[model samples]
Target: MSLVGIHGVSLRYGDRQVISRVSLQIETGEFFVIIGPNGAGKTTLLKALSGLHPLIEGDIQIRQRPIGDYTKKELARTLALVPQQVNADFPFTVAETVLMGRYPHLGLLAVEGKRDLELAEQAMEFTEVIHLAGRRLGQLSGGERQRVIIARAICQQSEILLLDEPTAFLDPAHQLRIMDLMERLRLREKITIVMVSHDLNLASTYADRLLLLKDGTVENIGTPREVLTREQLTKSYGCTLLVDENPLLGTPRVSLVSEKVAATISKDSGEL
Candidate 1:
């Protein structure tokens, strides 16, 4: 069964519908990327899938059961969300922050047990933040803080993870590192991952599948090789698109070419 499936899901703010009848499925063990221009509801769709926003219409299912049917605790156990930014001010150590993931398993007045601590430690180790376990959240750099938050989500031990623009503030190198780390974790744990990314080329390289959205509607869903054609991206972004395999990565990449450049390239290839 699919780890997560959305059947005509919709979300609205006041009277303006942000997500309109979006249908998609994230199979188990797949890294799925959702890409669209700004105001296309990519983050809104991620929020709806994470159950942070109530659905305005249609239904979503997790493991064959209705998403809305899951209790808060159950939902917490099934999926974990890693937001793009964190404004944490607590003096708690990184380990303590990660241990918070075990709240759903803890009793009302009980503290985290040894098993919980161990799990949190392992998550830190995997995310390469073990050395920062004792540092305060306010003391870490932006990339380090991002890693700690991701470790916290990893400690949640959920089968599905939803991330919204995970590489927002990092430098280009660290951004690629974070994405690579997430892809590795998903493979190692057989976890289904869904992320919103503005970097279409990185999304193409890492995601096993891509879902493209346009104006709150599903534009296309397929492998990056299929959905990331020059025509599709050009029309979606209202800009010239240049699709080609990266010489270094040997995978598809998207470039925002100027109209003049695109016309020249297109005519050279006899496409125009």
Candidate 2:
């Protein structure tokens, strides 16, 4: 079954509708990425899928079942969310925070048991944050903290994962590392992964499919090479730009024109 389905999903805040009849699917084990500019409703869509925000219209399904059919615990078992930011002053140790992912499995008022600890430890190892396991959230660097957040999601052991701007605070290297870890995890665990990213290059390189949103609507959905093309992106983003093949991946990569080109053209026009 497809891991996720967003069918004719529309969302609104009071009178302002952010998305209109946006539809897409993420097949089982697919690495799906959503890309758009600020206020394009990428984050809002992710929130709706993660059940943080209720759908104002239409529906979202996971594993062929509507989201409303699942209880909180059941939903947690099916989908995990890695949010955008982590505060440095939260005070919880990295391990402790990750262990919280196992709460869905715990009974009421129960403490974390050996298996939970093991899972959290394993997640830390997978994220390469084991050494920082004891470090407080306030003590970790931006990248380190981001990894810890993903480790928590790993501990959730869900079939599908949702991440909202996960690389927001990290440097390029750390961003790549987190994305690489997600790719490896998907292969090893058969998890369907969906992420909202502003970095078009990384999104195209990592995602098996790309869902492009523009001004609260799904402009296109297809493989990265199809949706990230020069023309499609130009129309969606309202910017004229160049598209070229990524030398390594041989996929379409978007490139904006250099300012010098426009400057030179203007100078020539003035002379004319």
Model 2: per-residue lDDT, tens digit, 102-194? 988889985998888989989999999999878899887888888888899999999989999888877889889999998999999998899
TM-score of every prediction relative to native: 0.94, 0.94
Which is the leading candidate under lDDT? 1
Looking at model 1, residue 214 earns an lDDT score of 90
Worst lDDT window (10 residues) for model 1?
A: 263-272
